[model samples]
Every structure is written in structure tokens, then in C-alpha cells.
Target: MANSTTAQALQNITGTIALVGAGKMGGALLTGWLDGGLDAKRVVVIEPAPSAEISALAAEGVALNPRQAATVDTLVIAVKPQSFRDTGAVVKPLVGASALVVSIMAGTTIASVREVFGGAVVRAMPNTPAAIGRGITVAVADDNVSAAQRATADALLRATGSVEWVDDEGLMDAVTAVSGSGPAYIFLLAEELARAGVAAGLPEALSAKLARETVAGAGELLHRSELPASTLRQNVTSPGGTTAAALAVLMGENGLQQIMTRAIAAATARSKELAK
Candidate 1:
């Protein structure tokens, strides 16, 4: 599996790995790396206000805010987009000139990262499911990124989940809309499905439980099945059935597809704006 490969890759890395900002996503990546057999002794964490959980890693030999910067091989930037400039300035001196830089900050461009870090940069967007190692990430590297560095970046990103590489950076905006921001849309579907169930006279708690289970189960089925989503939906809907009645309303003109398209467009636009 990809996870086992990532573990082997982590074991192969000889140089020090430095992580900036140990927040939710960063914490998830750290957990993935450590869980994937990366040595704690080779890790260095740069966090101003470390949580108790992150601080605990220090006991395992991971460095925490050392006075001097070590020669880093890979530097991961996980700080908030708004705080990147300030954070980058502080961390820039900590990284070696040839260190491979991988960034997960939304809307942060490769050029932007290079301007601050001046390394072979890869910009990636990962969804919230990465917390559970089910997330998918899309990444693009600059011309300066060597093949080995790109492979290394892929291995590192694959620690949490699947990785997709794209030659065009322009697609990242749409990728962010579809994947990075996609989980929220699915969550909203679950929320609205429960609300609709309540409107149909189901008990509130029961409606919530049913909606949650249905969405989660359907997602799991989708993951396991090789069939297309449309085929799966067709398989579930019998002619003149209750699902058919609902589909009559949902598939009508100006329904879910139209709304979803508009939503994705809005998100993509917002991503482009934030990049500026």
C-alpha cells in the first residue's frame, strides 16, 4: 500500500526534516510521518506556542525551537496564509539552500514560497480527511524541483493519503475548490439531509443519525466500489420508487447540479482572489 511505501521512504531520508507551525494539518502530517516510521530524532518542530501534545514529542528526542538552525533537507510550511510572510522570514534562515520546500497553505503560490524560502518548492492542497489518512492531495512543483525532490515531496504528502501531481499550476485553483473545500460541501449535504428528514416528521435525533450513517456508508461504498458514482446512484434508484420521487424534484431544472456548479465556481474564484 501507499502508506507502507511512505514509511519506507521516510526511513530512507537521511537529512533532518523541519516542520513549521504545528496546527491541525501540520499535526496530522506529523502524526502520519511518525506513524509511518519516520524517526523522531531526525525531526525538528518550529512552533511558538506548542500544545501539550506536540511538546510531548520532545521527550522522544524531537527538537523543539533550538537556538540555532540545523541544515534541513526537507522543510514543510503549514502556517496560515495570512501569517506566512512573518513566519517565512523567521524560518528562512533555518533552511539550507538546497532543501526541498513543500507547502500546504491554501492560496499560497509556488513563486510566493520561492520568494521567501528560495528552494525547490511544491505547493499542495489537502482536504480535512487527511486527519484520518483518507485525504487526497494535488501538488505542483516549480521547474527548479528535481525529479528526486519531486518524488520526495510525493512520498511526504503520501504519508497522510493519496497524492496527485499536475504539470499546470493553474489547475490548483479548481483543485482547491473541488477537493480542499469539497469536504465542507459533503458535510453540508449531511446537514441538509438531516434537516429534510426532520421536515418529513422523523425524530430529530433519529433523523440526524440516519443522515450521518447514510452519507458515511455511501461514501465508504463509493470508496470500495469500482463503479462510477452515477452508476451507483442508478443502482440505488428503482423506477417509480421513493428515491425516484425525490429524484424528480432534485433532478429537475435548476436543481443540485446547477447549484453545485455555481458553488464550485464561487469557491474557485475566491481561491484565485486569495492567491493575489
Candidate 2:
């Protein structure tokens, strides 16, 4: 992972950025790209629905729907999986042989994108927190992509938070389950933990606050620390303490590990099903 300074220093390279959708993930990327020194004039967003974000882009002089599709340096596909058939038709012209196509749609294969775009395709999956610059994106690209194109794609994606590259395309389903859909799982955990705390007699507001802050702070600590998660857990657990007691229940057989493994398996299978 690039440190904050390295990530910030990797900005300023410029090129035409055409986002074929203006949904949440696409809008977050557009925000990050602009923040990372990409000129609004060089950016084109094509969203027929034109949400408030698309309207804002229009006000900033970004082309909404152009008369003709022109070749772009980079094309970002952020439409939904169900929408790709239509999106493929709409975005084909902008994707010249040389353009690098980066897609953030989950379960959509790079081969599928190449079939439509006819270019160097990079499959990416970015989380929602990218809107606030705390997302992580995992990308994998075709071998035809040049080093510069890879770097450009990395920089564009890193603007959201951190970027990782995976070699095996099959692993993307697991990545999607772990990160793309992972945030919702964490959110659910926070909600359930808060409710459990409330049921255990803590004040409603206090339980909610504690649960949220605990998860957030733990996440931050994990991010900042170099130690492994197992070490961190060991460091926090004391013999016969509350944390230890909790772990006895949570870390027991058929506990968190088993539950989580099952959950991830289910999600991965669903991702494969969706791809089909």
C-alpha cells in the first residue's frame, strides 16, 4: 500500500477521462480524479439519468452527452452488471484500440469488456467509501496494456484510497466478496453489535456510539499498525478479562471464523452466479 505522501505525490499526469456512468462508484472516482489534478475540461461523463452529480459535472463544463463518441486516453466503465449490454453499445466508440478500459463493475470479466470495448481492459472493484477517499480498489488488466497505461490506471484508482493488482482473474470474485460487498457486512456487524449491547442493558445511544467507534477505531488501528491481525488480537486479550470472555464465545468452534468462512463462500458463489 502506498503511504499518504506517496499517493499524493503520484498525481498530476493528465489525460482525457470518459466515465460511462455517473452512479455512486463512478461519481466517487470522478471526484477523486478531479481532486488529483485531472482537468474538468478533459473529463466527459455520460449518464442519461443525470443525477445531481452529473448536473454538477455539466455545470463544471464536462460534456454530458456528446454528438459523437471520440477516442479517449482512458475509459472507465462503472455501470451495473445488468446494464453492460446497453453500456457496451453506448461506450464502444470511445474505446479505441489504444484506450485503456478500466471497469469497476463487479463479476464482469475483463474478457467481456474486451469483447465490447476492443481495447486493453482492466477490471476493477472499488468500495463505497471511495466517495470520502478511504476506499480500496483491486484491479487486473490484460497483458496488452502498456506500463504507462497501468500507472495511469493506478493513479486514477489510487485517488480514491489504495489500489491493489491481482494476477489471476478468477480471484476477482473473492475480491468482490471480501471488499466490494465487504463494507455492507461490516456495517451489519456494527448494527448487530450495537443492538446486542443495547439488549445487554447498555443505554441505546451509548451502545450505538460504542459499537460504531469500536469498529472504526479498530479498523484505523489495524490500518496504521504493521502487526498482523492475530497479533493485534492477542495484544488486546488479557487472561480471564472481558475481551477474553468475548473471544471464548466468538473464537470458539463454529464461531466467528466458521461463520465468516461460510459467509464469504456464499458471497463468492453468488458472485459467480451473477457473472453467469
Please tell me which predicted candidate would have the highest TM-score against the true structure.
1
lDDT of 1 by residue, 198-230 (tens): 999999999999999999999999999999999
The true-structure Cα RMSD of candidate 2 reads 2.2
**Best by the lDDT measure:** 1
Identify the runs in model 2 with alpha carbons over 4 angstroms from their true place: 1-14
Model 1 spans with C-alpha error above 4 angstroms: 66-68
lDDT of 1: 0.90
